[model samples]
Target: MQRMAAIDPIAYGANRNHYDGAVTRLSPYLRHGVLSLKEVSEHVIALVPTPRSADKLLQELAWRDYYRRVLGERGDAVREDLEPYKTGYQPSDYADALPADFLAAQTGNDFVDATVRELHETGYLHNQGRMKIAAYVVHWRRVKWQAGAAWMYAHLLDGDLASNHLSWQWVASTFAAKPYLFNLDNLLRWTGGRFTGCDADGRSPFDASYDELNRRLFA
Candidate 1:
């Protein structure tokens, strides 16, 4: 039997959301034995009232349970070089072009820099920002997914090895049929111009040059 120490209930409350303002103050309780997952799910059901919201909360909790199971099943294989679809794969001659400046928010591209800074400072990033950042690292910078996964594991406060590692591989096209990339215009709109892919008036970096940022990054 595994003995565990008590944790605060507040940590779980805060981490319900996966963003900057997440109130993950109740997670510790759920993580340890301070509170039970069944109790938490029931309590949320009671408070939410509406079936939709209650179901959503329940689903999220279930996902945590699923991840826990997967971790137990994979164990060492989680990080092992098990290229599922490869025929004769060997870890050799990887081409990684990740830039230190980019990871440090010194890339000079406001959109990319701001996203990295947000993740670094708050230990979280909005879902859109997550996609964009991943796209930038893989499509724009041409870095290996393993490298990017390592960087995220070192930063994100709520980082899960199962989710983070696999998601990185999916975005980089190693685990997916094609690479995941998003247009620069959508990136600007999602962050509400905070990162500003263009100008103050919603102009894109490609407006003058037919939006060649995509070609420059992906090419």
Candidate 2:
């Protein structure tokens, strides 16, 4: 209730994708039934003049409900790929498990390692961090989406089975039109330059243009 009461939907719409933004941080509450989505939506509806003013916040709540529906309909099938790899690599080409180096935050990518360390130390991560890390794991590391999904679900405080797994699927291109990839520019733009994408020894695998990355990772 307190979280919902404090929501600034306009700010959320403008800045929710940034590392530091006016996010409601209400997922854990909603996930555990501390609050209901209906009530939360209503609160936002009453706050703004028109529904459009809170459109982004309301849409995200709707997405949570949508994922819940998918979970109900799909059952455990959500744990497996719903579509074949669209990244020009066969299922056999991807590793079955996350690399030990990745779990240990020793992947030689500063942004990836820093996000790993943050997740280990804190139970929560911003949605952008989740997407970026997911893209890195499933795309760059070539680890199976299930592996990445399980790792995140095990640690996240607001871990909804549907959202966590399906989002990994999206990044893996098993549930989306194409694989999601991020470049050094995108990372720094969202992160506000907190991470330089440079590894400890001054190399950065993420330091490339999107076209260059597309050829390197997917082509």
Candidate 3:
């Protein structure tokens, strides 16, 4: 609780996308109801004493409430796509099972492999890492969003069905206008060069530009 109380919202907003960012690490507590979103938001605002400094952190908390509202309105439909996939493929066209390479952390993308292993070992993943892995699974591997959502729920200590499942659907383009894709350059920039030096390998799946990726994956 001290950690949560000490969060610097300014620092959090600036570095939240980085792998080693200044995140509050309060999701597990919030998910399990150890702390309420309103309480946390109020507390942070009190400490920060500036609307701009606390706005980003509060917006993040608001996403939790948004997901909860989605769950309330949709109920069990949250387990399925809320809208048609923009990729032109139906949910039935994707595999129900995640690939063995993905489960075993051998997807040939070092960043992905390490992130998966981190989830398996730590029950937590950075938010950016989670988005990247979700995009890779749903778009690149052609796995159903529900399959990846289920796998993530099973492992995440902070797992909330509304957030986890809906976010997967967002990445799959079932609830968004376009599918989310990440490239090697973005990965390196966010992760601080930990997974660099992949130019020689022709097998790197995320090395292409966004236009090329869209053509290859969604064409």
Candidate 4:
């Protein structure tokens, strides 16, 4: 709790996307009821003199609250897609279980495999990493979002039904207009080359432009 309380919200807002960003690793505490969203927000507000400095961090807290609101209203329906998938593929088309390669962290994509390994080892993943893996599983591996959600919940110490499942649905295009997809360039830009495309030819599955990705994955 002291560690979370000491986080600099201003720095968090500035550097939260880089591989080594100033994210306050507070979700596990929040998820397990050791901290409350309102308390966290208030603490950030007190530490940061300007409201704008805390806006981004507070916005994240608001997202968590939004998920809780969704869970409250929808109840067990949160286990399923909140809307029809925009992609033409039916729910039945997706695999019932995550593939062996994915579960084993052997997707042959170094960035993805490493993230999965980190999640398994540390029970935590960077938010950006989570989104990328979720997108890869849903759009690239053709696994059902529910399966991926369950896999994540099984490993994540901070896993909450509202945040975990809803975020998966958001990436799967069942809650958003289009599925989230990231390219090799975006990955390199964010990770400072800590992770790279897996193919020796420098053409991994995510090497395409966003337009190409949308066409290939959704068309």
lDDT leader:
2
Q: Candidate 4's residue-wise lDDT over 5-122, tens digit each?
A: 5688988999899878899989999998889998888888889888778989999999999999999999999998889888889898898898998889887778878998999999
After aligning candidate 2 to the native by TM-score, how far in Å is the CA of 204 from where it should be?
2.1
lDDT of 1 by residue, 1-219 (tens): 121222212332444333333333343455554766687766665654463555544665676676567668877565644353221223343345468888778777777777788778977766556666776676556566677777876777657676677666666655566556666556544455565564345554433232464455443
lDDT of each: 0.58, 0.89, 0.87, 0.88
Per-residue lDDT tens digits for candidate 3, residues 7-29, read 98988889888887899999999
Q: Which stretches in model 3 have alpha-carbon errors above 4 Å?
A: 197-203
lDDT rank, highest first?
2, 4, 3, 1
Indicate the worst ten consecutive residues by lDDT in candidate 2. Answer: 1-10
Clash counts for all predictions: 16, 0, 0, 0
Can you give the lDDT of residue 173 in candidate 4?
89
**What order do candidates take by TM-score, descending?**
2, 4, 3, 1
TM-score pick, better of 1 and 4: 4
- CA lDDT for candidate 2: 0.89
**Residue pair clashes in candidate 4:** none
73: Cα error in model 4, Å: 0.5
List of clashing residue pairs for candidate 2: none
- What tens-digit string does per-residue lDDT give for candidate 2 at 1-219? 567778999999999888888999999899888889998998899999999999999999998998889899999999999999899998888999999998999987788888899888997898989998999888888989999999999899998898899888988999889999888888888888889888788977888988888899994
Candidate 2 stretches with Cα past 4 Å from truth are none
Residue 90 deviation, candidate 3, in Å?
Answer: 2.2
